[model samples]
Target: MSSHSHDPHILCPHCDLLVTLPTLKYGQKANCPRCKSTLTMRWQEPRRRPVGYALSALFMLILANMFSFVNMNVKGLTSEITLIQIPKVLVADNYASMASLFMVVVQLIPAFCMLAIIMLCLPVRLPGRWNIRIAWILFHLKAWCMVEIFLAGVLVSFVKLIAYGEVGIGTSFIPYVLFCLLQVRAFQCTDRLWLWQQVSPAPAIHQPLKVGQSGLSQGLRSCECCMAILPVKQQVCSRCGSKGHARKKHSLQWTMALLVTSVMLYIPANLLPIMITQALGTKFTSTIMAGVVLLWGEGSYPIAMVIFIASIMVPSLKMLAIAWLCWDAKSSKKVDRERLHVVYEMVEFVGRWSMIDVFVIAVLSALVRMGQLMSIYPDIGALLFALVVILTMFAANTFDPRLIWDRSGTFENKEKFDDGQ
Candidate 1:
């Protein structure tokens, strides 16, 4: 209940509530009273912790690229693949879309995010604009880094390969696993507010702010790029120069547009073959459902369920959820907004996981290359499916969760409060 006028204030990104931040002890966090979105966190030794973890993660990432990732022996014929070779094989097979997706999500994004963390957390000085640019890119790209998802895909690939022949761990496997863990830890340690404060100071607010009030009512808005609180009239943030509106303009329109596109792409993605396998001079095409059925028929129920959930259920349900949210936000009828907010959070968290199936295909296509005995190649459906996942993720990003709360009468009334109130 630190309501002192001198305390720093922030507009909650979730519900646009302007909240006064209290001094937090180590390992403490502050959440918005209205929507419960985490406002800020106080980590112990934030700078040193992220730097160490990022440095270790970078070293592990380098090691992961230098050696064999997985080795398999099929009827005395052996095949091994390196971490870097996955994309190379896809490119060689002319599936550059899958290759680029694999490389960007698994390797490049993670590496760049870790490097950015180290640079921002360390005492090294750069131009203010450069620091802001790097920080802006870092936050935006961090969610897309899927090293952990790739690791999960690799594990699922191993289960599928166990039925084929003997599979063994490679020298690089441990390092890659370590890299995933360290990179995630590094990201967790790097607080968003702390990094922004270090790179550029928050803009001064001359007006009085009260906790538990909506920023929209106070004529204030938060910059999505840097979390800087600014007057609603200011369309551009002074800190990062990212243009924003009180709410994302036409958010529902953009979300529905992307959702419609995803549904259209999802049809082809399901009907067409996702992977082509050549075995014993016979070619077999597997669609998404066909692959799941084959895995189940092979007695790999858990792995089959994993694919079924990640590829099938997640994308379908996520789209439905987005459509429902858009409708709920538009309708005048009262709904449990808190529950909807929870659903929104879940949607955001699970959207990226839909990429797991694509990554699994990339792994299989790269490692199961034993000439005619066994080989897997990406088909058109893999690309289509990948696009569906990306589109749905974009849809989720465009739909502002704050809109769910904007219809509340409380915020509407606050809009009329006096400036000195």
Candidate 2:
């Protein structure tokens, strides 16, 4: 670890420790001594790796859209769905909001982020302002682009359709899968601090903040987007131009509103049918719990367990956890802030998977059209379920994790923060 007497100082986002950040050689990473969160890391061939991967991702994304995604054959009737059609189905069904959300997560956001990475990599020609804009955009967009998770849901839906007829993996499936991997790798290759250094070469480094004080009394505040330390009065980061804050304003109110909205939507998300399947004029509608029960009865123990956890257990538990955190907002050092922080991380990590049922419905609705022989359409509950997932996601995001450590006085002083003295 670098020492404040010699190296740059940064506040750890996870634990709020003001520690000296170590500069690393290629392939080396620095972790926060206090909380074990990775501080910064340098990659071997950092310049080429992300650029190569971004180009590859773009290629794979093109291929993913160019060819058919999947083909289903029932009797002499065959139905094929392309990657582009996933969002189109929702739009055709008058679910414009869901369509837009699906498009952004699976398609638009990934493309934009990868392109942004590419632009950021070529910082020599781009203006510093545009570089910051692109990097900042990538920072926020990466969380919502969930091609990998969507692929898992698609695979599960594909398996469920095998009993109906022959399901043929299309030319795009492999590329799309590979694209997801490449895109993820490309993102991992991104080093925000390193990128900032590239753009500016000499960023304004700050001394460790005076701690053991409340509010903005301390001179140093960390940028949530880049972890760059800045003067307390600076509204925008010099390095990333991201807005700085001593504390997220109205965090409790925003979280409470989102959490309550999630609870309100959860009822229909479980009670009403999300997917209505019509086979040979026989209609079968399955709610979240009903689907779980049916899957268990059909002996698909693993899938049933997964659906039960992602759809039912995860959302319910997440709301409870958020509510607990909100109710106990101002944590104390006497209490377990570490455990509380871990809970917040876990909630954010598992929040997105709750959309499994929604994605599965989308795939089923698109690929199972048999001209009335068999057809699956997303139901009212599908929209409501999607709302539930979105609300929970917002609930988690709006609830600032830093609030848990605020009253705890986690950052006592620089001397104590250094590897806990």
Per-residue accuracy of model 2 over 215-295 as CA lDDT, tens digit each: 344656767776666677787887777786766778899999999988998987788888888998789888878877877
Flag clash pairs in model 1.
none
Q: What 10-residue stretch in candidate 1 is worst by lDDT? A: 412-421
* Candidate 1 lDDT tens digits, 1-421: 4433333777889998776677777887877767777778888998999999999999999999999999999999999999999999999999987898898999999999999999999978896578888998999998799998889988888998999999988999999999999999999879898888888777776677765677788888999988888889999998888999999999999999999999999999999999999999999999999989989999999999999999999999999999999999999999999899998999999989988888888999999999999999999999999999999999999999889998784543322212110
Q: Which number leads on lDDT?
A: 1
- Local lDDT at 380 for model 1: 94
User: Distance from true position, residue 84, model 1, in Å?
Assistant: 0.7
Q: What is the Cα-based lDDT of residue 284 in candidate 1?
A: 90
Name model 1 segments beyond 4 Å from true: 1-7, 411-421
Clashes found in each candidate (C-alpha, N, C closer than 3 A): 0, 0
Where is model 2 poorest over a 10-residue stretch in terms of lDDT?
412-421
